[model samples]
Target: MKAEQKFMMIFRFTPNFKYQPTEAEMVQMQEQWGGFIGNIAIQEKLISTYQLGFEGKQIAADLSVSEGILISENKTLGGNMVVKANSLEEATTMAKDCPILKMGGTVEIRTITPMGN
Candidate 1:
């Protein structure tokens, strides 16, 4: 039988508090998940991994843009990862170790349905 392909895994992070997570906290969180990520990488299941920075920090002020009245703030949903797996169950099992969830973070797992070329 043909094996099921891997899919995209999205992690939604929401701070328990309104403020940004402290550097130490972020480090701790990453450390907690480091083993899991490493395991997946070794298994060649991890396709890509990304840790998003603070959205508020990317904002820029430009007087010519909108008279400094209208500002643009880059808002991101959260961090994400892509993995190869035989089934959603396998993917989910791999995601169970994500550290974000320990910090009250949420993860959304979805399959990557490819479009015909």
Candidate 2:
């Protein structure tokens, strides 16, 4: 039987604006999230994981130059993830453990299509 291929997974998260988690709370949250992803990794379902910073906070547009630049000195409000899976269903299933859901966050999963499609 042929082995299943992996694909890049991107998770879109919207934090609960009502409750802001402190640094310590964020650490705990990260631990739980890591544990969840680690479990999937053990099953050979996850290849990698990442937490993306808030979009707006990361990008700064220069009106004079009409260009966008990355600004690392800002506070981020949201996060994202990247994973590998055989199919969309698998990715969706792996996303079930995301801690953001408990705090009213949302997840968006999409497959990364290779080049030359």
Q: What's the C-alpha lDDT at position 88 in model 1?
A: 85
lDDT of each: 0.71, 0.63
- Clashes in each model (backbone N, CA, C under 3 Å)? 0, 0
- Model 2, backbone clash pairs (residues 3+ apart or across chains), number: 0
Looking at candidate 1, what is the lDDT of residue 2? 52
lDDT of 2 by residue, 6-117 (tens): 5554444444448887999989987988898788878867666666543432232663332332323332235455566667787788788777778665676776767895
Please give, for residues 8-95, the per-residue lDDT of candidate 1 as tens digits: 7776654333577789987886777788789999998888988765443333466323222212232234678989888888888888
- List ranges where model 2 is wrong by over 4 Å: 1-3, 15-20, 55-80
lDDT of 1 at 110: 87
In candidate 1, which residue pairs get closer than 3 Å at backbone N, Cα or C atoms, i.e. clash?
Answer: none
